[model samples]
Target chain A: MLAAPFQAEFDANSQEFSFAGVVRPRSVDEIAHSISMFRNAIEEARGVLYINVKRLAQMNNTAFHAFSRVVLDACRTRSDIRFVVVTSSVVGWTERMFRHLGKIEPQITVEVYDSKFYPGQAFVEDTSFIPILRTQTKMTWRHERKILPRHGMRPGITMADICCGIGDFAVLVRKEFQPARIVALDHSKASLAYARDVASNFGISDIEYSYGDASEMLLEDNQFDLVTCRHSLQIFNQPDLLLKELYRICKPGGRVYITNEKNSHCLGEPRAQSIQWTYNEVARLFAHFEMDVELGPKSRRYLADAGFDDILVESFMVTNQDGDPQDFADIITAWENVYAGEMAVKRGDPPEFIKRFRQGFRDHIFAALHPKGYAGWPIWAASGRKPL
Target chain B: MNAAHRQPAEPKFEPLLQFEMEMGTFLSDWHHCDQLSTYMARMISHNRTDPLRHSNFFSSALNELLEVSFRGGSPEGRIGCAVYRHGPKERVKISFPCPAGQRQFFREAVARTHGNDAYARYLDALSTDLAPSREVVLLDLAINFDAEIRLEEQDPPSITIVVDLPLEGIVS
Candidate 1:
């Protein structure tokens, strides 16, 4: 469902949009069917071979906490596990903590991946906070409604969306900045295929969809003027490694933008401390490497500790406005989908009560969004730059 | 007045309407309602051997009357004994072509069976009946004469209900 055939008739006679490999699921059932199709694909896909503690984090909290305590006790004598991926359901919180982690431990690179179910397949995107990113994007495409792209630029610089999920962000990014090169990376064949189809749909060939890890691939480093990591950390257990890679890959004078919301896994005193420690240690590593740093509001102190000189931290909250009923519904539905998906993935089973729980969540949102109901929260954004 | 010009609704129609309403309420309350239909149906059938004075005899008596009318080639084939217990607690049946649907018909039927106060007292008593006390109740089941309630020891109580029925000539 990810690729499409271009129409020569439209290209020759019409000035409308046309491209290659544009995938469109004919119906909702077809979309649901993709889940199993993706599962079969996963069965064939090779495992990267690492411990997924993030999956453990997805377990029921009470049980997970108890298990962690046992693990910690066991580790008292000897460390048993390393390399963890924490599946974070809460976006802004997750992003904030990861940023903080990056600052304190600039040596580690935490790649955050968001689990998204598109059409009939389930895949994880490099983006961690899907709800907020989708919200900031105006709830278009496979979400609430279709919106015309109107993205603002930071300056003269153009940025690329690496591991772009369905290219919703990439499409808007290309539409606005018309970046010199928009390279998107995703290992999932289906996801990359979909992204490629999306790029073709917009008739934008400048944006490239590559199927490999940016850190591992090392094909183009220090090439782009700007590198942006939005809501895509925590997928890497050794985030410290990622920082070095990002540093190595980006141009000497170029800036690396990393953003995430505060996350639940970054909560509780112990979990919080572990995250803080990771950030500080990495920051010390970065300083030892002689790189100037600027920690945004999300990772302020960590960036400072990471030896990032000339640190600049700014905080802006992306909000779902009070009158935006469509945004409200989309957020609730997406949030429930994410949470429900996490539960299913962790349990190693299909969502048993998805239909029932979805109805319950919808009812709850309708009640919450009525003139009698309103709720809002804040999202944290932070950026760190390399020494010029 | 001729039979065609009676100018009044038939007595049989009221009970049927009441039965339909009761069935609708039963389905709506299935998720949270404690009393199960299987248990209530069995209770009615079990009470058939008892005298009319028995507390559970009402449903059984009505069912028996329906059975005879049905066999006699009457329009009332069988009192479709739709038993439902959902109100606060307690098992209650509203048999139609019957009482509870038509106030006059119910009053007359109850008075004929017992006295003027009999139907009023039973209806009033049912309003304040106790809720079911079982921790877990299964609504759908096929039970037989030899039913067993097995309890397991645990902080939270657990029980298993088993029934034995005749399978051919072999009984275990």
Candidate 2:
């Protein structure tokens, strides 16, 4: 006699039906009311009717059978109406299970959403970039450990690290906060493999490193007390799509944490002008690839537009002075190779321009290693509370 | 398992997780299927290459089998579920209340899903417009998941069913 922990909503404007939550019932009779509502909605719909089960975390055979019947019957009755069953790759069985109906009914088609939405995933997926990512985190974690508490992180809370590249940040969070549970997800299989290997080698068995698309994730709604997606929103071509998903998974009264870099703001002494020009080009370079390396200051607008409130935004400088200058120099060295060597060449920049760009990174590293020098990379850390 | 269908030298399976409850209690609430399936999937999928993806597939398959146990058999006996693993293969074993006639019905239903025409029959059954209480769990799991299903008669009013799912090896 427990209440059904699921919902179905029909939108007349787009002719889409959304099913969410755990959709299990004792029998078809138990959901006859919702079934009749579905039947009526399809009767008046025209063109394509989208049945979005991307957020439908679980469904039983009884419910699936009932839904299949309704969709197939609707297809047979309305020849003009096409049914598109939208499933998410995060939920493994939905596409395959519903795909059978797509095969049997010509009018029905099943499309998995996450498989196609990762616009700039390739830049971050390279296994060769793993070391730089680790160095970047080692530098940032110092500032983040201080900033995280101001953003609602605490012990024993459920947490999720989306776009958790290589999962070093999640491991740091696990050790520092000791959250009750942590689920770290990323789109890169290679990155996750490395992350899994690192965690296992260290005997850190608590964190769950999962593979998933950031824009259209498979994690359920309102599950995490604190959700962190660091240095990720900028890399995705469609930042809003990724932000919307981050908002969706955050629990009411919880917070979504993010960090992004405005690459042009990078600074160094003794080679200030050259470094400035190169970092600006780095921003432009990322833009050419449909990513925004200069999205740091826009975090407030992004979070507010996604319907979050009590937004807290702060900026931190990861400088050579923060730690060993060697670590900072190493990160810059990797960046030069990827940005000027690979990316500029791919962008078809002149050799002279690539050489000049490479020079700026070399100067920044020089400044980092110089006894009287300073080099800094500024990042914005922002968090917004999901209203209760 | 039938001697005719058993694998020549299947790998040994060690029990990983188990849950036990009376049939009447489990059947009394429909939410158990969802809650239990979600919990078990999360528990068993931690080591897969894609834990989220593997868990989703495992949960879907487990939910279907749990539903079959929920709807079939009498409500006067105990029901138990045990999960076992051998590398990438995961097996779910469920024991539930059943009568002799209901056991025969299940055996015959499972039998229909073994041959080459099983998937086609599954499609046909889906579109046939049977009664409101139509049962097609076995056929769907058997064909869609390529599950290896075995049913064993227990005491007078109970039966145990085992399903082996090679979830990680699947391309999708």
Candidate 2, DockQ to 2 decimals? 0.50
Q: Model 2: per-residue lDDT, tens digit, B34-149?
A: 77887898789877766777887888889888878877857898989999999888999988888667887878776776777877777877776442232367777776677888
Worst 10 residues of 2 chain A by lDDT: A115-124
Q: Each predicted model: what fraction of the native A–B Cα contacts (within 8 Å) does it retain?
A: 0.00, 0.59
TM-score per prediction, in order, is 0.36, 0.85
Off by over 4 Å in 2: A1-17, A29-50, A74-83, A149-157, A215-217, A220-222, A237-254, A284-290, A301-311, A322-326, A336-372, A385-388, B1-11, B43-53, B130-135, B168-172
Give lDDT: candidate 1, residue B71: 20
List the lowest-lDDT window of 10 residues for candidate 1 chain B.
Answer: B132-141
The per-residue C-alpha lDDT of model 2 at residue A368 equals 93
lDDT of 2: 0.85
Q: Candidate 1's residue-wise lDDT over B85-150, tens digit each?
A: 221112223232322233333233323333445333332322222220011011000111111122
Model 2: per-residue Cα lDDT at residue B96:
89
